[model samples]
Target: MFNELLKERLLDAHLEFFRKDKKKFLIHRILYAVIVAMLYAMVIMVIKMPIWLIGFPAAFFIGWKFAYLKLLSTKKNIDIKNSFLFPQFLQSFIALLPSSGNVYQTLKATLNYTPDPLDKELIKLIQKIENGNDRNAYLAFADYIGSSEAYMVMNMIYQFSEQGVEKESIQELERYIQNLQENKVDELIQHKMNASDKFGLFPILISLFLVIGFAGVIFMHYMTNVTDALNTMPK
Candidate 1:
């Protein structure tokens, strides 16, 4: 009975914390709320100390930073990391496939010929379209992929599905796909360069210096203010 009650409590807590967006943001929000509530209860019931109240906002800041770091780690999950490599290969495979008369056939051909982390996602798109979903569904799926290049390519495909397919349209689509792939590669390279900048350590060191310097200045000012207020008191 006790275990069942604990499980229910945990589930309720999870539902309260859960969000459709980044789970990290939800986690951080929940953590900050819980911490603030606990702190409030403690102040009312246990320690009525002033010093503890000052730490409340700091708790939120720390929780948010930790949540962001956690979200970054999740973004590097196996499927997402594989997505970074799969797009080029998938594009190449799609180019090599024999000309299919319809865009849907072309997608099916690509799915059959290419195997990648994106394959499952593509298959789902195909199923959705087959099940009579509108062209925009595929576009939305591409958007969910969170790749601008993919979105562009998918948007073009959506346009083809709207207008009757033609050889010229297919050629244009191919050209656009190649261009998008190139842009993806360029973006990947830029990301790597940005990552390399992290190894320089300058940003981290400067941030630490600023934080320590600010804290010291605040402490000194606080002491000076307290001293002045005490002196102004009539002897």
Candidate 2:
């Protein structure tokens, strides 16, 4: 029950995270690990002689595909959600240009334009614009991407672009975002280094323990056999 709850919590967190950051690739790694574990269990259950012999490699290939499918599903969801915000950011950023193109005109141009993944999010903003909704609030995509630096930048941009707030406020926001992103990268690198160090120690320790334990058991069995043979040989 505890494990089920924990798994549910983790799935919820991943779903929530994928909803925000469409470009991240960690979801694939998780799915691959899950499928590998499933395949291992499946192999242990096969009863047929030939099938059991082949199950290991067969399960590995099937599990690889299963993992790929899982990763694709997660990516599709992320793409859909991220697509909802593309137009607004594109319009706002383009509007910063010296051209006289109005927001609607810019959106019309973009609708006909081929959208890259990042820019496709603008289509949702265009839909909101056409529906007479608040486009300013739609400009909050930058912060919605799950990065603190991105959120701060979007917040400042949202205030400026949506609420007709001061433009100069964005300068400080930019500086802050730069610093935050740098710090975040440093922290991530340090965390990976620590994880690698811990992982490196595991195989060596496990191998050493297994070797010593197996050798001791074998030595004891050999000694017992020698004593039995000697006792039985004379009288």
TM-score of each: 0.52, 0.47
**Scored by CA lDDT, what does every candidate get?**
0.64, 0.54
- Candidate 2 residue spans exceeding 4 A from truth: 1-144, 147-152, 163-167, 230-235
Residues 21-112 of candidate 2 have per-residue lDDT tens digits of 52343456456656875667655666435445455655555554554356446665554444333333433444442242344454446555
In model 2, the worst 10-residue window by lDDT is 1-10
- Which candidate achieves the best TM-score against the true structure? 1
lDDT by residue for model 1 (1-235), tens: 2343324333333333333354655666678667755666577557666667667766555554444444344544633654465465446535743566666777787776555566776787888889774867777667546666667767767776668666686687677667766866887799889978987788899999999999999999999999999999999
Give the winner by lDDT.
1
Supply candidate 1's per-residue lDDT for 108. 81
TM for candidate 2 is 0.47
**Residue 85 miss distance in model 1 (angstroms):** 6.0
Instruction: Tell me the lDDT of model 1 at 174.
Output: 74
